[model samples]
Target: MIRTLLMIGLIGFLSLVFLHAPVRAEGEFGGLALGNGQLIFEAQCVGCHVHGGNIIRRGKTLKLKALQRNHRDSVEAIANLVRNGKMPMSAYKDSLTEQEILDVSAYVLNQAQQGWN
Candidate 1:
């Protein structure tokens, strides 16, 4: 029925909105301010991850190809790697709170998709 079709469309629209909402969460700065993610990236992740390149692991670049191949194409995958760490990458789970990890993950994904411009 038309009712069922309308409900399906509504559900699809809602799902898109929820999935794409920015994860700019409140943090040490005190409020849900934006760009803190960029700041965190600069202070913490920029050294090796600058310009989407991994200084240590050349194969694990943040560019779309490497990310996709390593099964890290999603924000959750990146966040988990950052929190848990692997090999040369030390764990930030203790250093960064969950919100900070989420923010940085969003930043990295956004930057990577833009070719790290």
Candidate 2:
């Protein structure tokens, strides 16, 4: 019947819209680094740096304000710290490869720069 066909068409349209809706990720780093940056953060940095706060509160916090003070908006500095690991900040060289370090660093830097919802 005409009603059945119209209902089916409406359902199909709504399904497509729902399924294809833009996926907004939780942090500022989403859609960057081909979308793998956040995954790297979850794997490497989540335990000691939950939401940019250090677990022991020893190192400088990683939010925008702290990063402005410590890193001074230098992505390279942040990257170097991630690679070399300042004293008391466990060196990730053994646990993560160079690329992994870069990815995770990019993720953190992005979040530190822009913040997240």
Candidate 3:
């Protein structure tokens, strides 16, 4: 009975560890662990940039063409913009960490490339 209890405890512990583990994905988008980006975007940016479309400024949309035209085609450019707000847009430097800005920038670029579909 002791052996069975020990095995069950071990199994439960292993299950918890695996279930709580961060899931990392390998892919073209720098193999980033993706959940944080989407979650952050949803929580912070979705209101202004829903589906990559800019409600505040149509010309400043997050679409690939707009991003390219505005010289924000790269992740670094996007991250900088996010960190330091440009006029109408509010800065997120205080609210989000650098890593989080990078993640969301990557996500935005990826979504733009995919046409936000």
Candidate 4:
């Protein structure tokens, strides 16, 4: 029947909308590298930020309290810092791609939330 055919088409349309929908909002991060973030963090940042403590700047550690107080809680803020870099902290922008920065920043934030475990 024509009604059955229309229902089938409607179901197909809904399926496509749910499965192939593009991300359209900020703070989504659903498309960003999720697990690889940890790998990037371990490979590049462990030496300096082992256990989230800053070896060079002991006072400016990556601890959650410090990050919250300094307003570095969001991924954008952390990623910007990593990309730009401050004294004694080299810029990773040249070495790591934008995606790498995002992944590593996400890993850092997740680890900080988990007490660097």
Candidate 5:
């Protein structure tokens, strides 16, 4: 009975630690962390740019080819567009901090590179 209780307690502790831990990626971009980017993207950008595709404009997507075609192939460009609103898209400058903007931009670029798979 004591062994059973101890095993249950150990399993419960491990479950809490693993389930609540933040997810992290393998690398960083421009000295910025990469993990929160996904969280921020999910929280803020997922509605409009689900899976890196644009809901409002089919021509403009977060996909690699479209981004390159639109000349928004770089992190700075993406960050700028996110910071300043384009037609049909809302600017996140007021709502998100600079670091968040960069993080989300990096996330978009990374997703684009990965084909959003």
Candidate 6:
């Protein structure tokens, strides 16, 4: 019985260590490195906002153009809006990590600067 218990504890400890291991650097999200921004965007935003196309959501148009313009003023604003869920836009605070939001905002900002028209 003692051996079984010790083995179980060892397995649990190793699992926790692996889970807490630092993720390798992928890209920047907000100020956070090793962020998973693209994955979050792909899962959440891509549904309504297609690749440079217009989609009607809750009676408001979700176009890349509008988002690009909105992102111009501030990345923080975009992040906050996504976090808090601006009207006509669902709040992603529960769905995404803060870093993910920041990364998505960065992606939008980059697309805007490039004039993704």
Q: Candidate 2 clashing pairs?
A: none
lDDT, residue 20, candidate 1: 54
Top lDDT model:
3
RMSD of 4: 12.3
Arranged by TM-score with the best first, the candidates are: 3, 5, 4, 1, 2, 6
Q: Tens digit of lDDT per residue, candidate 1, span 1-117?
A: 999999999999989655754445454434432365676787798899888898999998989889889999877898899899999998999999998887777777777777887
lDDT of each: 0.79, 0.68, 0.87, 0.80, 0.85, 0.61
What TM-score does each of the candidates earn? 0.70, 0.63, 0.77, 0.71, 0.76, 0.55
Over 40-107, each residue of candidate 2 has an lDDT whose tens digit, in order, gives 67666778888888877755878878887885355556667877787777777777777666666667
Which of the predicted structures, 3 or 5, would earn the higher lDDT when compared with the native? 3
Tens-digit per-residue lDDT, 9-89, candidate 6: 999998875575434343333344322444456567777766634375533333445664555335677688779986667
- Using lDDT as the measure, name the better of candidate 4 and candidate 6: 4
Q: What's the true lDDT of residue 29 in model 1? A: 30
Clashing pairs in 5: none
lDDT pick, better of 2 and 3: 3
lDDT of 4 by residue, 1-117 (tens): 999999999999989655753332234565666566766777788888889998888877788998998889988999999999888888899999998898888777877887987
> What is the alpha-carbon lDDT of model 4 when measured against the actual structure?
0.80
Minimal lDDT window, size 10, model 2: 21-30
lDDT of 5 at 109: 89
* Ranked by lDDT, top first: 3, 5, 4, 1, 2, 6
Which candidate, 1 or 5, would have the higher lDDT against the true structure?
Answer: 5
